[model samples]
Target: MYGLLEVHNPENATSDIVFVHGLHGDREKTWTKNSVFWPQKLLPLDITDARIFSYGYDANIAHFWARPADNRLDTYSNDLFSQLNNRRAETPAANRPLIFVAHSLGGLVVANAMVDSASNSYQSLSSCIRGIAFIGTPHKGSAKAKWAQVGRQIIAYFGKSTNPELAKDLEEKSEKLAKIGDVFPKLLKRRNEEAKGRIELVCFFEGQPMNIGMIVDESSATLSGYESILLNGNHSEICKFGSRDEENYTKVVGHLMKWTREFENSGTTEEAKKVTNDAYFYGTNNGLQQHTNSGTMTLNFGMRN
Candidate 1:
C-alpha cells in the first residue's frame, strides 16, 4: 500500500514523509480534490527536498455478504512497515530519514507500525523515522463506532454471516484502541531512552461538525500532553486541501516545514563510531583519498625531483 505520491528528484531529497489513508479511503482520492493532489502539488513548495509517499489498504469495516477481508489492525500495521521497508531497500532514498502524515485509521496504522519498529529486528527502519503528523485520527473510542456496528450488523443480517474482528475494534471503547493509547506512549519513551532524539508527535482534529456531529471529538482525536491542532473543516475534508492558501493547508504545511527543519538538524540517530585505520600509499607520489557519507577528504604528499 506504500505508493510514491510525488515524482521528486531523489538526488536532492534527504528525508521522506509518507501519508496513509484511513477507513474506506483511497491513497490518491483521500488527499486530492478536483484532481489536484496537494501532497504532490502544494507540499513540495515548502518541503522541497523531501520525498513524498501515500500508503493504501483495504479498510472495510464489514464486507458485503461477509466477504473475506484482512480484518486485523495489527496485520495492517505489519504490512505497512514491511511494504515500506521493501520499497526503500534498493532505492536511492534507501536510508533517508523518514516521517509520516496519516489520517483516521491510517494514523492508527502509523502509530502501531512505529511501535513495532522499536524492536531490534527493525532498528534500521525505526532509526530513520523522526516523527508523525496526524489529521483527524481517533486516539480514543469515537461516536462513529455505533453506526459502524449497526452497518456491520445490517450487512451480516443480509448475508447470514457474523461480524468480523474489525467490526468489534471499531466499536466505542474498542479493545484495540485502548491498548494503542496505552502502549504508544511507552514506545516513544523507549525511543528517547535509546538516546536517539525522542519521536515527535503532532495531532489535528476537525473543528467543524458534520451532519452526524463531531465523529471524532477533540478528546478522541488527540492525545494528552502532545501538540494538538484544529482544522476548520469536517471529518472527511480535514485532510484535503485544494490550494496552498487554505488555512488548513497553511497550518499543515507550517508543521511540515518545522518538521523538515528539525530533521535536517538532528543529524543521524546513530553516532558514528570512531575507528582507527592505517593509511597505505601505493606509489611514491600519490594522494590519499578518504571517502565518507557526507563528502570526501584528500591529502596529497608528493616530491618533485
Candidate 2:
C-alpha cells in the first residue's frame, strides 16, 4: 500500500486533516526539518481537535530505467481516492469533516481526486472535504517543469533512462495539465452549488527563489475566489516550518481556524452563509505582502523585490 502515515489521531476528534507532499518528497521528510516533524510536533498542538495524516506515493525525481507504462497524475489521484475511501470505510470518524493540505504537484493530485470522487461512487468523500490549502501549486504550470524535463533528458542521453511522460506532463502548455486546470474549477463550483457544505480554498505561494529558480510563480499558484498569501521563503522552504513562532506557520494556522469554524457552522446557521459569501468575494486589493518581522501587512500588487 502507498504510505499513509498518521501523525496524530486524538480520540473523539470531529475533523480530519491530510497532508500530500510534492514530487520527490516523502511523507515524513517532506514536512520535517532538523529531525522535527511539524505535522506531528507543531500542527497538532495548534489544531488540537483534528486527526492529522500524511499521504505518500512514488514520486522520485529520477529513474534508472524506463517503466513499461507512463504514470500520470490520474494514476496518483486514483491511488489517493482508493486509500481515502478504504479509510472512510474502516474508521467511524474518518468520514467526518476533512481538510486537505497539498504541496506542488500533490495539489494537482488532490484536485483530480476531488473531481473523480464527485462523479463516482465515492461522492461522499467529495462532500466530506471542507477545505484545501495549496502550497506553491502550479495550477497554470511553471517554468521549472520545463527545466526538469531538460535535466532528465540530459541524464537519459548520458546513459541512465528516465520517464519522459511524467516530465512532459509538467510543461506549461501540456494538454494534461491544461485539462486539469479547466476541469478542476468547474468541478469545485458544481460541488459547492450542489452540496449543503462548501469547500473553501486558500493558496500560499513562495516569494523567494531556490537553486532551480522560482518553481511556481505567483500567477501559476493563485486560484480565483480564494485568498492567496505570499510568504518569505522558497518552494521547498514554504512547507517547512521550523517553529510555531514563524510567520508562515502562524498564517497557515490562521487559515485552518477560519476553515474549521466555517465548516462547523455549515448548513446550520445564516451566519455561515454570510461567511461563505464573504470569503467568496474576498478581494486582495491588488495583492498584498505580509511582513512577519515588523508585524506589518500591506497591499502591494506590484512585483516583489
Candidate 2 all-Cα RMSD: 16.0
User: Candidate 2's error at 95, in angstroms?
Assistant: 3.5
What's model 2's overall lDDT?
0.70
**Model 2 off-target regions past 4 Å?**
61-69, 141-173, 265-305
lDDT of 1 by residue, 151-211 (tens): 4433343343434454554544244555566787777777767766677788899898766
lDDT of 1: 0.68
TM-score, per-candidate, Cα-based: 0.75, 0.74
In candidate 1, stretches whose alpha carbon ends up further than 4 angstroms from where it belongs are: 1-7, 62-70, 92-94, 141-173, 271-305
lDDT of each: 0.68, 0.70
RMSD of each: 7.7, 16.0
